[model samples]
Target: MGLQVNIIKKLPGFELRVDFKADNDILGFLGASGSGKSMTLSCIAGIVTPDSGKIILNGRVLFDSENKINIPVRERKVGFLFQNYALFPNMTVEQNIGFGLLKSISKVERIDKIKKKILDLQLNGMEKRYPYQLSGGQQQRVALARALVVDPEILLLDEPFSALDEHLRNSMILQLKDDLMGFKGTSIFVTHNMEEAYQLCNNIIIIAGGSIDAIGFKDAIFNSPPTLCAAKLTGCKNISKAKKIESNIIEAIDWGCKITFNYEVEDSIADIGIRAHYLEIMVDDEDVNTFNCWVVFTSETLFRTKVYLKFSEPIGDEKDFDILWDTSKEEWDLVKDKPLPLKIRINPEKVIQINRN
Candidate 1:
């Protein structure tokens, strides 16, 4: 019914340590590059071995260092869609799709399954095309079809859509969602893109420096990340060192301001964060959680603009930019017409309190 992993593997700089259980759900391993997300997948797929601890899938011991039970890759029943797609260079699309089928099945049955997978994955006319003849997105689809045709007990996808164009990526995502909906076993999706993780997974595990930073339901984790690393990985752009000055207020040390929160501030509040979009550019200051901010700079994109504002006196350093306020281009146009030293408001409910700086 689930996959349980409690494994530790030593990497060059740090130990890859993690422990989590995921039910029959699409669980995302979210992290930055070189954060051991891919290594974790390789361990679960039996391509890499952990130094210690155990990995059990559906009550079966896949890897147990103490018991000396490390299942072979083919016997682990894992469908791994590697980052590179890993298509056979010499094999045609249909042959690659049929490579994983059981030899015990009749030749007719195998052909039927292969044909079905090819059609399902939209490789109808390119069945005889070789891997070198196909595009990146097409090769990715072929590899995915091959993995899915075998109907393995578990699925591991490492940045499955990293090679596709945006439109095709979205299309493949819908297709993958359909495939996962019918799949009954556990699926682990590894990705550094926060948006992809949010869109595809029911739950997410944030990894940083080869350590498990946070793990929980996707919405709960996004709404409230407990640690500083988790908050930053979840795209909280504005963060500052903080000290609780009152029951419901804290001083933003780096930003040179005091922020009030609706919830009681805890003594362990070492950092505070607010998403850039949560910041509001106001013409006048509010009674609470509002301060006069001087604009340091503005960076504009086609659709949006990032405005950096300093809330307090200049710290007289070259690296002294305070809060980042992200707004739409149209909204920036509206705000830029105002005078200097504009009032900025911090929505208390949107403030994220972090236990670690």
Candidate 2:
């Protein structure tokens, strides 16, 4: 079964208008802060109401404005894991997990259900601990246990891993992935982290300016972003204004260079994007897009070295535009002793054409 959403809601300064559908696979809502990713999840979970449109899950109508149907939050059968875990401070882990179960169920049955959840989340001995007494990972597991105990039709996560430190975040991510494997419901993960989205989601929806910019399988969207915003959000560092000059050539006005594309150049292409890692240091000017550049700045991390460079040939009266290039530490070591006035090659095949409209 799949989830379908086509909704609109107006806020004081922003309006959210999104429409997409997802199957039982994990779907990601990838966006920047305040871009409506969490709001979309809230609408799905019945935490927030859309001014208009419909939401359907597995053929069940969750919200329909025209038909005047709005399911109550409790009856929606959707589980939500908030950014802060949202666990009761005073409640024991056992009581928190069993909170959603019906009161009519016998005490023994409820205890059995809670026991199973504790075992599944590896929270067996911590069942009586309070939220504050447990570690970050344990608290997260308790939240997940609470959400999953009721067997929701849809699971919604809003920046669920944002509060953890690096080590704990990675560990919890793996644990969450394992726990989600046996889940029989559609899962929606909302996040601004590109790496997390790519790692956890089977499909991704890129939201920008309170609207969906693009939605597709993870690899397709990352490899070939359809819009300039999409490219930026996906971490494309080198982008320039482009104008089509010929069937296979486009001039990047900002970079003061012309790119020859093997694919047909579209008139609608308003920009060109190139990933930082795609720019290769030129040992010799043998490539078609090879150009002379000056190193403006350099920075290095443990794994990779970052170089910022500007085109040697400046555009008329305009400030020089810089482009970022990243090389692995291994590659950087070989060229660390290279002379000044660096020359770089732009891989024509790796260049991405973007249509802003």
lDDT of 1 by residue, 228-333 (tens): 8888888999989999999988999998888877778788889889999999876677558878987778899879999988875555555467899999999888
Candidate 2, superposed: residue stretches over 4 Å from native: 313-321
Among residues 3 or more apart in sequence or in different chains, the pairs in candidate 2 whose N, CA or C atoms overlap within 3 Å are: none
lDDT of 1 at 46: 94
Residue by residue across 1-357, what tens digits does model 2's lDDT show?
789999999999999999999999999999999999998999988889999999999999999999999999888998889999999998999999988887788989898889999999999889778998999999999999999988899999999999999999998889999999999889999999988999899999999988999999999889999888889889999999999999989898889888887888888879998999999887787677888887666789979998778887445655445788899989878876787667788888898888647
Q: For model 1, what is the alpha-carbon lDDT of residue 255?
A: 87
Alpha carbon lDDT of each predicted model: 0.88, 0.89
The 10 consecutive residues of candidate 2 with the worst lDDT sum are 313-322
> What's model 2's TM-score?
0.95
**Highest lDDT model number:** 2
lDDT of 1 at 227: 84
